[model samples]
Target: MRILLVDDHAIVRTGLRKLLAMVSNAEILEAKTGRESLAIAKAQPLDMIILDLNLPELGGLELLSRLRQFGPAPILVLSMHSEPIYVTRALEAGAQGYMSKNASPDELLTAIRQVSGGGRYIEQEIAQALILQSAVPAASLAQLAPRDLEILRHLAAGRSLSEIAEALGLGYKTIANNCSLIKTKLGVTKTADLLRLALEAGVS
Candidate 1:
């Protein structure tokens, strides 16, 4: 199996390398930045990619998007951020599985194997969080894209569109478009109702 590990820390990569060695006849490659990971991913076909959400040079989600464009390969996220929002973002960004750093080594291997075998995996805690969010019938999380969810959170936190655009390093027009999409998806034509939905989703 050819597996590419994407993480910024030498120590984390070292640990992951040892754990992934459990794969039968595994050939592992390492990258310390999102850009580096994207370059390697484009260079060859990988059986799997284990990535961390946080990275330098390029954002991990953006890197995941770029890698997905190359074609299908299991991309498992190993990260410290285990919240539902983060998990949702990772899944929406094309991660095949999400494993929190707090998970047992056994779970780590299990998630890797499952995703490599063309299955999806999400941590139990994250699953429960999503389920809890689903208790509200209106403003379904499914309607929002990852980026939309992010903007929703910002809006719920009392950020203006200009502030959100500056905070996310995006154009004001882009942020406005995303906000409009969020409203359309959530079936809320009013900004106040959108904020209420965001709050209901526990974004605030």
Candidate 2:
């Protein structure tokens, strides 16, 4: 198996490399940034991709869409966020599997096997959460795209539009426009209300 590990943390990559060694005949490639991962994906064929959502410049959700244009390789998102919103956006972005960072090594291997074999997998706890969340009335958070969610998360963290633009490598005007769109979608007239909603939704 030819697998690419996309994560910015050296320790996490090292741990995953060691864990993936359990897969027979597995060859691993690593990238610490979204740009590097895109370059590697474009330059080679991969059997599977293990991606992390919290990349340096390019967010993982956006990267998932871009990577899908490269090949048929299945993507398994390994993220710290186990929220249903995160899982929903990832699946919508074309991920074959979603596993929280809290998953056991055994579960990680199972997720890798399933997704690489053209099957879908989600962490047990997260799957349950998704089910419960689905039972509730859909809200504006469900209407937000992955990028919009990222912006809301940053806003909940008390980041200004300028800071968010810098972090996302977008223009300030773009971020401001997105914030307005987010407000419209969420039915809020004020940024403070948006921040409150984001916090209530556990974005921070």
User: Please, what is the whole-model Cα lDDT of each candidate in the order they appear?
Assistant: 0.80, 0.89
lDDT of model 2, residue 136: 31
Worst 10 residues of 1 by lDDT: 133-142
What overall lDDT, based on C-alpha atoms, would model 2 receive against the true structure?
A: 0.89
Q: TM-score of each candidate?
A: 0.69, 0.92
C-alpha lDDT of residue 145 in model 1: 55
Give me the displacement of residue 90 in model 1, in angstroms: 1.7
Residues 24-114 of candidate 2 have per-residue lDDT tens digits of 5799999999999999999999999999998878888889999999999999999998877778888989999999999999999999999
- Lowest summed-lDDT stretch of 10 residues in model 2? 131-140
Clashes of each: 0, 0
RMSD of 2: 1.7
